[model samples]
Target: MSVVTLIGAGQMASALTFPLFENGHEVRLVGSPLDDAVIDRLREDNYHVNLRRTLHDGINYIKCADVKEAIKGADLIVCGISSFGVEWFADEILPILDESIPLISVTKGMLDYEDGTMQTYPEYWQEKLPEGSKLRLYAIGGPCTARDLSDHDPSFVAYCGPDFETLEWIRSLFSTDYYIISLTKDVVGLECAVALKNGYALGTALAIGIKEKLGDDGIDHNNMKSALFQESVKEMLELLRIVGGGVDNIMFAAGDLDVTVSAGRSRTVGLLLGKGYTIEETLEQLQGQTLEAVVIATRTARAVKALAKAGKVSIDDFPLLMHVDGLLNEHATLNIPWKKFERHM
Candidate 1:
């Protein structure tokens, strides 16, 4: 059994920990003081997950104060931290990690400050690692939610990277009665798809919320909203293309099918925002924390506009690009006419 060290005790981390423990792997969970409180609650309550109504049946708790101590002898290191925490983690923890251990990131969303300059998660981590350190990095993406996994719902997740053997090993480790793990070499595509989907989800949510506000109005707002969502999905895919990601990434991001525009937690957050609730207000109302998509949609919209201005992409191909830009910039009055957007039908 591999000794796995999971850094971050968030919902996602907690959801996955049960599977690792059940599979007989030794799990060492390292967390901040706040995260430690979450762990304490889990242990005191006999390990309850909101996602799953079932209770865990094993010794799943192994808390560590420092990341170095948590991962010192670990065979694999899983990072489920939020995107915002990644840089701090790389600075404070990655340097202490042994080069031999493989690192798997379950986080999604790009570093806005990095722009498209940093293409993939592995590349970002590699830049932080010491030169000549042979560290294998892999990314897990697809539509598997923490809620589904916590409740032992049958789910599939893709593990992809340049290291084929390592990817296969990870696939094997995660494959269980309820969890199916697929391996791939399209690491960049996979990561890009994961990041871009957040923006699409948010944009779709906003469109839906707007449609609700325009009830019985002259515009066939529901139909227009649906088209807007579809167009946004296509636009996001195009943006990913400019960044060198594959069409397969879209399939993975959409959960191997055409996902409804109003799907996922991030989209729900967007809907709330569209209903005149500020970001902070939406967060307070959400049953759980919102993903980076709410902010990412805005950042990516700016970056895409910059790239478009630079002649790096075709503006005509991404009509909704400007609309997303308008939404993100809080530009209530857009230069583009509303009737022109409706004409796309």
Candidate 2:
């Protein structure tokens, strides 16, 4: 059995300990500086504070102060923090990291540069490592959620890396009967696909909010939702093309979109926007919760705007995404822009 040291006790990270521990790995879950409360909860009882679920027993819980010692002799390292923890992980973990140990991130999002360029988390992390470091970077993307994985639901996802052979090795460690794993060498495509799902999922979910605003709990606006879903896949494919990723990567993109449109913080924010809440009001409603969809939507809109200026992509090509971004950042009201979608068709 391998010793798998995870660096964050986040929902997805903590849920992951179940499969790994069940698979006979020695899983050490180290809490980030932000996860002290959750770590204490896990220590008190296996109950996870944020996830609202009990985790598997026999997993070791290490505090933030002991992260160094917790990672000792780790056969594999899981970068389980969210995007907000990227810099912190670099500053606190990278310096002491063993370059030979491979790392896989469940973190989803891309970093936007001053020039409006975007790079996936793994790419950004790779650049921050010491020159000539042997650390291999990998990320998982798909529809796996914290609650579902915690219950050992049959969730399918892709473990994406630069090398196919190594990804198979990673698959061997985490794949279970309930948690099926697929491998992809298209890192950019896989990362972009999953990150794009967050924004598009929010966009697709606006119909629910719209239906609620229409004062009809009995009627489902699945028609509008399905249209948004299709347009999302189309735009996602174009985004991948511009970024030099395989268009076929839409498999993960569409599947993630399907799952995300109905659940998570993305849907929550989208519902708020559809109910006519201002971004400030919506954010207040989500106080203390992370909105990955809003973060990626606004950042991707800015990046794509730069691309549109460069004639790499048309700003008009992403109506749902741009509309969602406006609702989040521009003080714009909730308008579906069905006209823009028609033009796209």
Candidate 3:
């Protein structure tokens, strides 16, 4: 069994750790110093994951006051922190990580302030690790949710890495009856697909809500919704293509369309926004964590513009780019003519 060290004791971390423990792998879990209450709870519970139906136990717990002590002898390090916290963790924790240890990043989303760069969790850490370190980086993405896995339901996720051996190793570590893990070699494309799917989901939710509000007193609402979804998918695929992603990434992102467009935390946030809720108001009402898609939409709008100017893609093929640009610029009342968009096609 591989010795695994997981950083961040959030929902994702909890879901991943339980499987590792059940597989007989020695697991060490580290939580942020600021999360004293959660640390206390984990200590009291003996690092058992109380999944409501099943209790998973025997994982070692460390209340990380220092980084070196947390990852001294770890073979594989899994990071489940939020995207915004990546840089901070890199600076504070990754420097102490073992040089030969392989790393897995489950976090998804683009860095909005960083020129709209879409980086997976491992990529962020690789940038911070020692220059000559032989650290291998891997990424995990797909439609799987923490709640589904915790409930012992089957869910699929795609894992990709530059190293085939490391990819296979991670796949072996996480695979279970409830969690299906697949390996891939398209690391860049995989990460980009994961980030762009969120923007498409938001767009899909908004279009659905708008269609419902338009009072379908005789309109082909179903066709409109279908067209909107297809167009959004195409737009995302095109955006990814312009940024050098592969067709397989597009296929994987589309295959996982069920969760993105269906009812979920991110889609619900989009629905609320469609109903005219301000960002802050929507966040408050949901009482849930915000997905990085909101910022992604804005950055994607900028990226589309750059691509169009560079002739990487035709503006005529994606009129949504123009609409998104206007939307991001706060000109919310503007609309693109269907004929103009169709002409480009």
Candidate 4:
């Protein structure tokens, strides 16, 4: 049992404290500046308002001001913040971080450029540090959701870092029967696969949303849903090849898509859009929630356009993602682009 500190008291980060507390680690849940309300709730009642559950007493809740003291001797530091908080984390947390303390992130996202280049969250964080820093970066990927993980459900996820021994040690800090972890060194592949799934999930839900919108209680759109799933995986495979990631992590890609479509936040956005909700209307409905899918959809679409311009890849290969981008940004409706799929084989 080591001193495990999780920064950012968001849903996923707060939920992850379950494993750390259950494993008998001296866990510190540090709330970022944005999580003042969450920290207050935890301190007052050991309850996470978002998860709507009471946590164990073994955990220590710290506020943003006391973050320096909370991470004083933490053996393992988990970057449990979302992608949007990376810049803040870098500015506030990285400067005081010890290079020796292992850093693993629960953040799932990619930094895409117009030149067809992409970097995982860990890599992006590494670039923020001064050159020659020994701060090792790791990321968690796959289908595990905050709700499932918080409920102690059996969730499979991949932990990608550089060293096997170090990754195993990090896994030892939190890994339990229900919180299963698979180790891999393909950091780029794992991150790309997982982050890409967020966008595709919206498309998957469009199938369901459209069917439900028609008031057709007679038939289900599982066939269309499955087709979207297959096409999403295919585009993911093409992306892996383009972004210099391993194509063998197909399970991570497909598994994440399945899980997100099943219960992830992106599913809700997709459903609303599929049901003929306007982009502004859908966003207004989900105002406070973190819209990872919306951000990724637009970014992925831009990346594809950039790549196509560079003659690196064809934009036609990613019809689902493109349609998602159009749906969210271009105010395009739920046109599934069924004709664009299965053109490769």
TM-score of each: 0.85, 0.97, 0.85, 0.98
Ranking by lDDT: 2, 4, 3, 1
Clashing pairs in 1: none
lDDT of each: 0.68, 0.88, 0.69, 0.88
Minimal lDDT window, size 10, model 4: 216-225
Query: For residues 1-345, could you state the per-residue lDDT of candidate 2 as single tens digits?
Result: 999999999999998998899999999999999889889889888899888999888889989999989989998899999888999988789889888888999999987765667889989888998989989999999998989999988999999887888888888888889999888888999998998889988888888788888995677678877888888888898888877789878999999998887689999898888889998998999999989999999889999988888776778888888888888888998888887877623
lDDT of 3 by residue, 1-345 (tens): 888888876667777876788788888878765544565677676543432223366777777675467687778888877666777678877777776788888877665323334455566577777878887788888886676777777888899898788788787887788788878888777887787777667666766566556765677667655665677777778766765778778766765555777766657655665666556676688675656666666667766656557666566776664554454356464343346535433
Winner on lDDT (1 vs 2): 2
> What are the clashing pairs of model 4?
none
Model 3 per-residue lDDT at 344:
38
lDDT for model 4 comes to: 0.88
Clashes of 2: 0
Segments of candidate 4 deviating more than 4 angstroms: none
N/CA/C clash count, model 3: 0
Q: Give the per-residue lDDT of model 1 (tens digit) for 8-105.
A: 77667767776887888887666644466656666676454434333365534545466666776788988877777777778877887787889898
Query: Quick one: best TM-score, which candidate?
Result: 4
Model 1 misplaced regions, further than 4 Å:
48-64, 112-118, 211-225, 256-264, 276-291, 333-345
lDDT of 3: 0.69
